[model samples]
Target: MAITPNYYETLYITRPDIQEEDLAKIQQKLQDSISSNEGEIIKADKWAERNLAYEIQDHKKGTYYILVFKALPNASKEVEKHLQFYRTDILRFITLKTTEEAVNKNKASEEKKEKTEPTTPTPPPAAPPTTTAAPTPPPAAPEPPTAAPEPPPAAPEPPTAAPEPAATPPTEAPASTEEAKTENTDTQEEGGTN
Candidate 1:
């Protein structure tokens, strides 16, 4: 039967006072153990040193390292056996079976962190040119002034009030055409007789 490998994550803490060389040696030993057990490591990184929740082996602070690998269950047990017995610098350790999805999620989060981390300083924006004034020219000879052109005449002002209308006698119009003709005939007859 084909054996299915299982993913595992191991978080191990070391003494805060451990030397760099000693720490590297300790890491190398664990890695060697994992490899010998036919396990393949996916990620191995050191976490920041910090105060521990509770002292282990009288250590209030420790340096943490994480190791994620895929291997047969028997192979993982072999690796853990080495950690539990052979290693002395390790103050505490925990190994847990994990899903491939969790491993991918962790990988993505680490990539995101690296991308957001600041890089080398960028050059500042180019500065504007300096403001020192250029050399002034020598004074020139003054010329005689000529007559200035006059502006066009202004438009006439508008009248303030309109003129009063001419006076005329008020006359009533006849109510009908027949009435108007009778009045005109009477006036003409009167004029003729006079």
Candidate 2:
């Protein structure tokens, strides 16, 4: 036979009326037995009294207890044997490998996260953005109008000279004798005015 290295947990139910004092005594005895057998009692959790699925020994409700312990493989058989001998209990049990220290199980590991002050002091709240500096949010951006407005480039140069400044001066004058004479004179002198 070879010894093994691992742990197992067991849960069983006992009659509900078996008062807390007796329950504690029974648990202590079991703990002692396990230690005496060269095993360590990792943890024991007692659940609130509750009803069972079926009556075992005519008791409708029972106490649910979970025991986590580490020991050789034979330790499981020892626990089962003790549970069977104690007929006062409904005596249902299970055993499995433990993944962590039972004491920390289900307990929040982050208790305020070991709070530390920030390396840099907190900055003051920001004031409402000023209209002059902070650009306006441009109203919910209308559905990108079918036509987008484009701004001309910032750089400006001298306006180019007109190509045909005199191309349409004839028709601009009213058709009157005085106007006719003025137009002929204006064209003959190349835009010389009286």
Q: Highest lDDT among the candidates is held by which one?
A: 1
lDDT tens digits, residues 1-194, model 2? Answer: 66664677788888877767876767777777677667898668785588878887788888888888877666777777777777676446666666555435533342333332352234322344464446656665754542222211111111232323323333322233234444455565675452
lDDT of prediction 2? 0.61
User: What local lDDT does model 2 show for residue 29?
Assistant: 71
lDDT for each candidate structure: 0.67, 0.61
Q: Candidate 1 on 1-194: residue-level lDDT in tens?
A: 98888999998888888888987776676678777767789988887789999988888999898889987777567767767763567888889999999999999998888886654233322222222222222223222111111111111111221112111111222123234345555666788899
The 10-residue segment with the lowest total lDDT in model 2: 150-159
Best by TM-score: 1
Q: Lowest-scoring 10 consecutive residues by lDDT in candidate 1?
A: 147-156
Pairs of residues at least 3 apart in sequence or in different chains that clash in candidate 1: none
